[model samples]
Target: MTTTQDISQLYPNALWNWFAQICAIPHPSKYEAKLSAHIQQWAAEKGLPVVVDHVGNLIIRKAATAGMENCKTVVIQAHLDMVPQKNADKQHDFVLDAIEPRIDGEWVKANGTTLGADNGIGMASALAILGADDIPHGPLEVLLTVDEEAGMTGAFGLQAGMLNAEILINTDSEQEGEIYMGCAGGVDAEIRLPLSTENTPSGLRQYTLYISGLKGGHSGVNIHLGRGNANKLLARFLAGHANELGIRISDISGGTLRNAIPREAQCRFLIAPEQVTLLNQRIAQYEQILNSELRQTEPALKVRVEESDTQADKVLSLSAQTRWINLLNACPNGVIRMSDDIPGVTETSLNLGVISIENGHGRALCLIRSLIDTGREQVESMLTSLSDIAGAEISLSGCYPGWKPDTSSPVMKIVKDTYESIYHKEPDIMVIHAGLECGLFKKHYPELDMVSIGPTIRFPHGPDEMVNIKTVGQYWELLLAVLARIPQKTA
Candidate 1:
């Protein structure tokens, strides 16, 4: 894998240079100390005022250029961390290793991990604007937040009085021309079930059920895509075998993050020896059935079950395992409602993103999203009650409010006009299903006017993630136009 430094000679633009430098540091959420230090060092070198918050968020401000002092102060915001995920075969460590980003024609991507371009581009744009003393601009502050992927910890932990910008330009959306006016609030619920075990029957055999190759994505945005949830499917198989073959689970694990649909899952357990041939036949039948069921959306789905080393000790007692399997099967995943306000938009969705059996206990993690607060609460309550009924202890965290759309704001108009003037067409303005830091920022700065825009990015939060190289220039032009056209603030 070639590091960013090795490609600097080939693509040497200042914006790309900045991105490459950031890529050299491993900045996974909550593990962003090194990346934050780099930003602080850059700010000190430029003689800019930099503040380091308790959660590692860094805000660096620069004085307005000579003639732009009277212009309103604006904050360019982006998260400093990226989701740490990769191909199962990849050997990179997200905490101590740098991402090896590569350029493919007009796109930039990582070798086998997510390209941090989702927010790396935002960071690069801020750096480019701040460093360009010759570029036309106004008083500016760049807020680089940490732990955005894991929980928005940086924004959640923001101090009472840390910022002064009255206008925020969030460069975190993926669509280049579209302006994200609002976003959905989200919460993660973790369900844990106690364990009990039973001795294995003699002449029984162990089998591992494996599901992989499904196209997993951000649970909120892609839940409606009908992507296969391997955890749920695996549980269904185990439940079906509970009475027929005397299946007792040894271990079950799937999905790494709470916000991503499970692409792969594997379950190891013991089954009656006489049923080995019968189970193999059933596995083949299930692989075919799943293929047919998910063929339209998850064409690459694969399901296989094979014999594995039997654990000396059972993972879940018979009773506990039965309840756990029942809970997994009962939990819902995928789109729950379509937007009544916007035609063809998904209004609410759910994802059973993670399941694990650890230390003889089982835990399930799920994420639910909705544009309407009432609907979100409805779904969350359902999951809570369901977990309780299953006798599993439930905990919810990382809840953040949504950004209500403001279609008539002056800042919103300015961004729209800028895009029309530059692109010669109207840009789409819509609300996203995923969470953004803008909502949290609004809590602290209620009077702050905000609009989010960014270059085109695809498959964010996954290893196939990439950013459009050409759109970067177009987005930069639009941002500059918006700055130049900023109306004088009312006293």
Candidate 2:
């Protein structure tokens, strides 16, 4: 009974070593060139044929084992990039500083930053198999894609016929006991609310009203958890009293990534000196109301008002302030629809993920996701209508199709059986709410059967991300068992 959580000494040294090596390098989304090069170099050293596509996806190949020459060629897919998120006090840079991972009680986590275990653990398992010769398997191909966090650039740009594997195993799914057969499609809506400044009103004092201590998680996976969204909460206070109290905005900033639910948000604004007491009262009142409303979901939710001496010559004009505050309050967040076909599965949702104001312009980004195209369209149309009515400009980007679930998938059956054999029970076979590259891969390789599996990871795309250590060993063992049990290619 080893109770060590240090990943280095965790069971199965090869896989953990690979993950540790990855953490030493900065491979944040849109900045995977270094990690890509490192993998390519490792492949070259091992004499395996590695190809880097125009979009920077890596396909490293290995020959079948002695007795499995007739088995189906397998493609194990994992993304190379991790979402870059950090606590406000954490001084680590995603593009420059390496992630410092440590052992918690039962999980491995980073120091006030994302642990990168979402796909890093999966990627490491693939590399472990690729670097080994004793693992029994058919022809193997590891498709390491880039920019999977910010966008599915590598998966979308993957050229057809590049991989002849009849089956693909995606190592990006979150939980260990559930095997993902499909995933949602998504589109990002970017809002640009025009800004104009008016001369500061007289007899005003500056203050920063902030919402913090919210436990934000992945927008797609945790949207239904009813956690408090800092951006929306901050807007509620301002929206309720902006006009009555004449709260002139100086600058507003919240959330970091469009794919992450905003954990904390703050606004720096000006108010009449006499209204300071009233503003404090409002925040204290609202904080209690919010905490009660979200006591079950967000236990640490906090709202505060602090006096500030920050300089500001002008604030948003009355019209701009009204529109911005209105849009924030009206924007929809959280699960909008539930799957009628799949019980307890989210069918459609929207996350008002990031909001910021700078350089005379304010921007708010919303990410829409749905299991069906019509579901996504309905939300997009609704967002467009809201933006238009609020006099805000909106544009849609990064639109990707959903991975429709196939209940009769052959490879999924194999994976399920393997999990049952290992754990003495059936694994949950279902579609995921989050976007995986499988949708894009299925578009390019319609004949290819695919399934996603991974170790248990919690709070991805944020600073609190952690991976369950025990599940990593189980996930690795199951992946190897599935490969060894892969049925022979049929003529």
Candidate 3:
């Protein structure tokens, strides 16, 4: 596969060149040390001061350009990690391979995997600014936080006294014309249920039920799109047919990241030799039903039953199977409620994004998001009740508060006015439904003013992810203009 595909030849060579370098490194969440260290060395070569925080975040600072020293210190921020998601047929390893970006029509995408353009462009923009001595800007600081995809470890571990900036421009938002002033808070729920297995009956054949080809996206941003969740689909099939087909599941697993909607799932089970024929017929019938039900959202959904070559002498106990099926059905996996306050905005949502059942244990990882504390709490309350009745243990962690909108904020005003002047039109100023680290930054640096901007990226955190070519240029120009117009610092 072509690694770079001439993206470095795109407009703004300085920015695209940096992005090219980033694509060459593997920087998935929890595995960003290489990329972080690479950037530190790169910064040192540029003669810029670099600071490494205890949480593995990189802070690179540069002095003001000539006359712009009087302007307020501006911080450009972007997360260094990208979500690792790929199609079942794809062989690329996110932690060992370079993202091969290819230009298709007016957008740039990858070869059967996520393009990582959601925040790669943002990081490139910051690096570009830092590399240029001609671009007029105030005292500049580039904050590259690690592990923003799977978790917000860097942001959560950020110390208050580390930053001396008055304004923060987050390059993590997806829309080019949209200015994100606030974002939802989120928490991850990990549900665990102990399992027991029984000896498999003789003359039983092994079969693996597979579900794939569904478009799984960012759990938060695409939850409202009504995409099919592969885990939920697997549960639906097993719950409906386990007893009828006399299936004894040996192993069941689906999804990958807790923050990403699962695109594929599979269940390995044993069935009687005579029932195999009936099971095939039923699978065909069920596949038809699922396709019809999800025709609009999941046209390419595939459900198949394959004979497994691996031998199994054990299967989940009948009681364990029942408990697992019931919990899967009872669990909340999509949008719970839309915001009554903000029209068309999601208020609270849950995604049962990942699950694994094997080795005498079953685990389900879910992510819950909400704009307000109470809304998130409401969903948590439901999960609490579900766990109580399901005889399982549920734990919530990585909880972070939401970034509340500040319409009267001076930084908000500056961004709005600057966009209007540059584009000659009003930009969409709104709060994002997804989680952004701006919320954590607000909690840690209450005195800092923040806003988010980025190029138009589609299907982020999925194999179908892509970035629009034209908007990259537009976003870059707007970012430069915003920096030039940073308000003068005052007491």
Q: Which candidate gets the maximum lDDT versus the true structure?
A: 2
**Model 1: number of clashes?**
2
The residue-by-residue lDDT of candidate 2 on 1-491, one tens digit each, is: 22223577886788998999899899999999999999989999999999989999999999999989999999999999999988878899999988888888888989888989989999999999998878899989999999998889999999998997999999998898999998999999999888899898878888898899888989999988888889999888889988777789988989988899999999989998888787888888898999889998888888988888765888899888888898999999999999998899999999999999967778999899999999999999998999899888899999999998988999999999999998999899878899999999878799999999999999998899999989999999999999999999899
Q: Indicate whether candidate 1 or candidate 3 has the larger lDDT.
A: 3
Worst 10 residues of 2 by lDDT: 1-10
- TM-score ranking, high to low: 3, 2, 1
Task: Give the whole-model CA lDDT for all candidates, comma-separated.
Answer: 0.83, 0.91, 0.90
- Note the clash tally of each candidate: 2, 0, 0
TM-score of each: 0.95, 0.97, 0.98
lDDT of 3 by residue, 347-383 (tens): 8999998899745678999999999999899998999
Model 3: residue 417 alpha-carbon error in angstroms: 1.9
Q: Flag the better candidate by TM-score, 1 or 2.
A: 2
User: What lDDT, from 0 to 1, does candidate 3 have?
Assistant: 0.90
